[model samples]
Target: MNTFRLSKRIMNINRTEIADLIYNKIIENRSAIKTQFLKTNETVGYFFMDDLLPTELALEIHAKFPTTEEAVKRKNIREFKFTAFQMNNYNSLLEEVIYAFQDERIIQLISEICNLEAVYGDENLYAGGLSLMGKDNFLNPHLDNSHDKDRKRWRVLNLLYYVTPNWTLENGGNLEIWPEGLKKKQTTIESKFNRLVVMTTHQKSWHSVSKVLKDDVRCCVSNYYFSDTPFLNSDTFHITTFRGRSSEKIKDIFLRIDNGLRSNMRRLFKKGVRENPHQYKK
Candidate 1:
């Protein structure tokens, strides 16, 4: 679809009435939501809400997702998955649902629950969009890139909405957060259907996804919020750092050195040698 029409669809999705309804549902559970996030925020800073949207609507969005062949593949030691940000590549419903999280009311509610300030959603996507992982596909432990596309705002939080119906913990494409550190045991958050997970991302938040055990594809809609300040005083600019799992010692050492080299390159060239290709063109 054309950008003009796509923009209209996004706007329609955020019409005041609809936005208020979404806002109210979240606000009604605000106390519980805040408690859940605060309980973990001191360690890793994350929280999840099941049934973030109406199940039928969430299922419709998932049904509209592009197949693996239609999305871009990233298969390397760091991760193996499919991602797509170009809005035109998917149906209008997918675009609508993605931007729905960008709605100002929703943003305000999320910021309040997380006790974060000056949060802003990514419009160009900038590595925030749709992702899919089939059997054997996995993402290694890693920290997200520190800044926005322009290197202006700090990437503070990651918002992921899982819509694949009937997904379970045993399915294995769950989110793993290393609250204490990679050396310690990690917490597993199941990629449950129609769930929305919001997690803080700073210099030390190390997270990954377990390998998919089922033959099915797990699909997710992702978005990032940027801010003027780091989430913690200890936070600083860094590349998208990666590390091998606790079991892979050799790969861990190699990735540590690899991250150091990439960090150096960023220090010298603020924008890097080339532009990041993972962004919406319009």
Candidate 2:
């Protein structure tokens, strides 16, 4: 099989090989990534690596991404995007890449760099998987739900891998980190093609994606790493909370109330009002 050739069906690429490539790249920039994360430890710790995968493989993945129309559309004030968690329904190669990050060695390396421990991967892809955003799609500044689907583990790190070739600054959908709370300035991380971003998820790690300025779809493969304990002693249970951008004052009020109500309900219900349908059933 010609590894460089593109086809209707992706050639079988071993996850171990993919993991090795990722490991090497992280190793290559270990100092910078580690320093970046450590310096921001008090706030939202993060670091990104460009050209995460080889150009050929990255383009192939982008070419195989299911269109926005084919995935789940989540349109509302809080966010507007499409997400796909059920990997069996997508290209086999997509599944391979998603699981490749879950490779034990990669997890350990990431854990070390972030000064975190016992970080484990989610096989079920709970709120973690393929997401695509086209024009006007935006994710508000928010904290991820504190725990995994079962509420047993604390979510510690977020992994985002971009495969959209030629994605640019003019293109919105870039990751925005509000390190000094939402009122202060925000740090924008371009969702550059073939880039992988890793960030610590704690109580103060508020982040969002800028609205897509172009008609093009910004594609990303996302995954989360959980730990046995919370990243900070102050971290506590909270649902996936979101707040409107500064311009939307009314929305900000509504969302805050909405968050409070949800938190109250969770206190009463414990597990939640019902099962969250976001996880991969298989």
Whole-model Cα lDDT of every candidate shown, in order = 0.87, 0.91
Tens-digit per-residue lDDT, 1-282, candidate 1? 333543455434543434555577688778888888989988789888887765556666788899999999999878999998998778867777777788898998899888889999889999988999999999999999999999999998899999899999999999999999999999999999988899999988999999999999999999999999988888888889999987999999998898999999998999998999999998
Clashing pairs in 1: 41-45
Superposition error at 11 for model 2 (Å):
1.6
lDDT for model 1 comes to: 0.87
Winning model by lDDT: 2
Report the error of model 2 at residue 270, Å: 1.7
Error of 2 at 19 (Å): 0.7
TM-score of candidate 1 to 2 decimals: 0.93
- Per-residue CA lDDT of model 2 for 1-282, tens digit only, reads 234442323467767878988999999999999988889888999999898887888998888889987899999768999998888888988988999999999999999999988889999999998999999999999999999988999999999999898999889999999999999999999999999999989888999999999989999999999999999999989898999888889999999998999999999998899988788888
The true-structure Cα RMSD of candidate 2 reads 2.1
